[model samples]
Target chain A: MGSDWKVILCYSITVLYRLWWIPIRAWRLPLKNGERYFQDIEVPEGWHTSAEGRKWWRRYRATIIVPHALEACGLMAIALWGQWKQLPMLSLVAPVFVGMTLAFIAWWRHANRARIQRPQRVAVSLEERKLRTYFSWSLEAALAMLIAASWAIMAWRGDADIHWRWPLTLTYVVIGLIVMKAQVVKHGWALPANRTAEYQHWDEFRRRYASRVLDRMRFMNIVILAGYAAVHSLAGVAPIGAIRGAAFAAGLGLSVWMMIGIARGETAFLRGSARSLLPPATTIIDWKKGWWSFGAFMAGLALLMFWPER
Target chain B: MYLTVDFEDKRPLYQQVVDGIKELIARGTLREGATLPSVRQVAGDLGVNLNTIATAYRQLQEEGLVAVRHGFGAVVKARRSDFAGQDELRKGLRAALTQLVLAGLAEKEIVTMVREELAVVGGKAK
Candidate 1:
């Protein structure tokens, strides 16, 4: 393809790719803490018989399905129509991502308000939580190395007046995510009253995965930031595009890994119910926010590819 | 260690928490220097009031079974012989034996039951 055609084609592919992942909008039942379990994600078997489930479904369209449908259509419009304005895509979507994350934090606090309490015959050992308990050591090492490399590249590429400001701002965001994760795990967390032994095991398993999802979200964010830094630093070089390629590879690779791990669903939950957890697992990603980093990665890649008009 | 606080439990909520944690410490499920979940966390999990959990933690600290640090939650301290509640624990045990006696068990059955109970509670190791 011609150079301009190639650029336009890649940009279109990105926008179209994102639009395709439009929010899954799977209907859920009105069970308290139901989202944490799979039974709530889909129409429960024989749910047409349950008055509560059916009652909630009655409001499903106006309260959920319609509003969500409109929002998705609106976003689709922006993705398609906004291209002509040539607004830097990150500038377009970054605020939305940030707002969604904030919304999530708020929703999390709201949902986590203790709902049930009952005495059980059994006692469980409280597992001491640490960042490493969920996030792996090698992943930690990789993050450290990536940060070091990003700094190294920026130093090698820029003059004495390097743009330290942008990285600093991004660094603050990364720090915020860390604090958010800590807040999430540290909060007064509880289970539904009278959760059975099997349910408790399942909940704990979900929680561990939830914590890992938080770590993975942090890792994904850092990777995207590092990837951006590396490519931007390589602004003058051409063949070094291979190294630029690495950034996309790393981000994309992690997304795939996250996908596989979540896809191989465990516990008694139905298959594909994990789709409801795409954003950050039990922290609750849902469809739109779940593909958030992938969207961010694509936006960065498309922007960088089109930079310099090279 | 898992703890259940039945609303129907006869003991004070704080005492139940204090006893439950002590049992775990005795069992070595919670090792020295291990941190307990924050007061807010325990309160939320058990659906008890925050002050109730805090009171329990303070009692544990007073007894020297666990050390409470600001913002760091409670940490299991090394099992110390200097426990200020040594007599209190003794009285509690005597009360339990009295219950066994009142239940009209044969002396052998009572002795055997106490031993079995000790083993279950990790008191035998202690």
Candidate 2:
């Protein structure tokens, strides 16, 4: 494929993926609500009506999600512009990522404002806040490393085309899945402790998984770009052609294996009986809606597979 | 000025704050007649709303652990009669004993065990 065609294909995939995220984002708000209401049966003492308790929720939302959304948009713009034009994607993505990251720094200030503007009690606990912060930072660090590594791979292989490296992409996807599962498991375990604080529970689950999955998907796109570079570099060699063919076959095999594993794990998780293990203030997410959304995403992926790049 | 709140505890937040102040008074960290930080100042320092600290101070005032002046802010008044330096250790022991009892330890057995442990510690001190 010519360079322009490659750029166009990249841009198309980015747009397609962004479109897929729109429905998931819309679903997230209501799903969060459902989880909160469901988990509110047994909240711990001192959570509701406490000033610190109220502030925890404000910090969690403002510090975690708002900043994450801004960062994701900035990264998407970079990835989009880089592929659409010849300029370096990192230069565009990095500064914006830094700028958007300021939202988190402003979290405390925002929390104070929120507390003054609305004096309602927030139900999230200090322990929960610490856990969420740890997970959020870990995800952010992993994503940064993944992006840097992919870009480095591109720079290292200069003129050499690298085909879609399924292993690298799969690694990130697996990490995202693990993080999501861990979050859900945490919520499930916390259900019994403080049931009245279900809203905090649901918010934590959404905050952890949504940004995580989105970031990993963005990382996956960068891997796909690297693959595109590889394919373009090897347009003429007989031996390299044979190797590329084998890799493509292996990639397809691995993707299938991962899909089955993920589906099975999700099924088992959803089938298990619900336990009031989480704190009452925390929310327990409804797996039914989330699983349905996942299925929809998979179907979209299938369509992308058959879509003509030309 | 260092403060931490644990929301999961069954005790009310106001009670927790009062307990914390009582400990400070017992330890002489908050001396009699010493003015305490304004509720808003303490609340901001702890990342909590001002009302939480105010409620805590109110409880302390009711218990005579603190006296809230009109403009000067809350002040340490009289410490509890048992507000000696060893309240934390005593409180911890009481909690431990309660847990043991709840776990089915007989009262007599708990008393005997406490006596034995106290004897051991007393011997070491001597």
Candidate 3:
């Protein structure tokens, strides 16, 4: 009976967060980088709006919907079954499902690359420049603050076993450091003050592209941070070890899903830009560098956190 | 109709732009009286200089393929009865055939290839 609540809580947060994110992403679709904003694609003669572009968007929405629904249903069923049988491998199932969905998104982008509108170069306005810069630093700071707060709150409550606290703290610290490091990298590679007209044009587009991507990444981080807080808080509320473990696994899986989604988009962008006339301003940041560091950090932290508790 | 310019190609970018638009026009993908993307828009889309697009448009105007106006953008003009440039086309065909023959394509193969190209264009027009 106790485990049932844990499963429910875990699944509810995971599913609801993803459901919420999809609509937000679609609403901001026109704001993303593209040769023409999705909405700006030309319509046929005598038509005021673009019916073809609408169809394309509908297709994109449907593609995303099917995988997301499948993940939710599949993971919910797995979580329930795992709780009943005390299966260890069940925890691996959610990550696998998430991985498949992200891979599908990457493949879909590649397959449709030709059909998709090439990103257009637009003049970056003054207000737009300021807004992007503000969002960049603020979002990074907000995420770090959120993680640190969660760590502190969990420690102060003392309701959950502290045995896992050390590893959790370490995870938070490492993630915080990575976030900070990325900010420094951005600042270091800031667009030069004086540049040729061609380079300037390229830089404007690059900034717009980077800003749009960073905005999406920030939104995903919000989802991930919330997932972490929810699971960590479950310790005191649900005393059952099985239930707590299930919640933890669900939270961890969601984080991986969010990370993978961001990585997939960034990877597609990098690949698409390979043949571009203007490359990114500086050396491109490798997703591998960030993901591998995060992965190794998590693995090490998990060992320390879980082994001691066990 | 999309005008794709390959930055990596050795051919001059402006020439590629002109050729691409002409091909589209010949295939009927871009119909007469259609508005081509504005010079500014093309420059932005291709990440090339504004003058490059202007040069391409100017070449098209010379061929009587497109018309540029002050307020109005470049529009595909109807082909005149004379439809100039047949002599240039013959020259290009001669050069191409000479190369093909040198490369050992038989008379039969060259004729078959020309028919195939015409058929493809005809199919697209339909």
Candidate 4:
């Protein structure tokens, strides 16, 4: 514990920096990052110049900036106090994150409400909508299988009395998650303030982009949960300590990966330059990346499935 | 697929939906095998009742322009002009021609207009 003091201090400072950065970024969204924002959202041409666009921006700014600023101040006060008083500062991190998240939700809901009553012409694109459009079905299926097989193996070599508990409880939970993922994939959305035909196209593009990001996040979560599950199931097994360490390290690595994935979007926003909203067609089959990940996951599963008996 | 509902249109909402979709099919915008948005999706988008969109889809299915299968939603079957019998088409054509005549169009003018309308509905425009 004494030797780890420097690392702990460094982590707390990083957390404090991130907490301060969130609200500052949120506040600058309308000013410093405005152009990048337009690029990411692909607002229709002339949207920024139109009267309705100006009005919508006013409402949007008020909704986002004020609440976020207040939330940031409250978060910083608590975090600073915790740090100075030598209290358990890590507990403050989750509250700061949650507060920032809720602020985002509040503004998004407000923007959704500001869309005109009866959007009049609702446009769906010619192509069929599917989760597979944004996420790889093969990857999802592989995760489900990996989770089930892992839990089953854990059950098989169990302590006899409560061996069935994790498998039984988690199987239903996994099923529920898959269903929820399907439902939430392209469900309710906040339409852009500009609702032109071109904007509808942009909206579809935005939806797919957001869906892809969200699917990766969901996939990462399942991996993390499965890692924790693996840790629990192998807790007392000596030979599996290496496996356990790898699982734990992988969990932390993927948590950072997911955060970096989300932060990539924020970095694009803050870059203050227009990046192309339309990713070229050829790169889309990047769904191939999922198959690769699934293959690696399957390999790990194979190792674990056979390792138990040896 | 783009859809809109007018509060002021004298026609029933279901009829408007049916006609709008039929026009889209005629224009070749909705091609064979393309999936139509679900009835619930169209209804929610247009702020109309579910039955209105369902009736539109059912009418499309009966006309052979779309196939509405259970659970899979509706899919475009084909651009089915043959489904409309000759006499039924003539009656509608005669009413439109009569309106043009009442507006004092010359024979050449009426033919030109007919050609233009036909071209707009997927025929080759001269």
The number of clashing residue pairs in each candidate reads 6, 37, 5, 0
Per-residue lDDT of candidate 2, residues A71-120 (tens digit): 46655775666544542232233233333334433443344433222112
Best by the lDDT measure: 1
Model 3 TM: 0.32
**Location of the lowest summed lDDT over 10 successive residues in candidate 1 chain A:** A277-286
Best by DockQ: 1
Model 4: residues with Cα > 4 Å off, grouped in runs: A2-24, A28-119, A153-177, A184-197, A235-241, A266-310, B1-13, B44-48, B81-83, B97-112, B124-126
What DockQ does predicted model 2 obtain? 0.03
lDDT of 1 by residue, A107-216 (tens): 43345334212223423336555555655678668777877787787777854444565565455555655655565454323333344344455555666665555566
Sorted by lDDT (best first), the order is 1, 4, 3, 2
* lDDT by residue for model 3 (A1-310), tens: 6546645555555556556556755434432434433322322453324675456556556556655566556666766665533332234444444444445444544554454443332221111122334355675687667767756755665445344544354455445445534442232111222232444455444445554544444444444444455455655565546554554665556555655555455445444443333333221123334456645655654565456544
* Per-residue lDDT of B95 in model 1: 93
Query: How does each model score on lDDT?
Result: 0.56, 0.48, 0.53, 0.55
Model 2 — TM-score against the truth? 0.31
- List model 3 lDDT by residue over B1-38, tens digit each: 35655555677888978877777777787788877766
Give the better candidate number (1 or 3) by lDDT. Answer: 1
Between candidates 1 and 2, name the one with more favorable DockQ.
Answer: 1
Interface RMSD of structure candidate 2 (Å): 12.6
- Candidate 4, residues A1-310, lDDT tens digits: the string is 5434533443555455466565666544544424423312334557766895577566556655555465557557756664433322343434344444445444543454333143323333333456676667787778878877676756655444443433443454445445545544434222222333554554454455455455555555566556545655665764456765566566556545655655665565445233332211101112233335434544443454334431
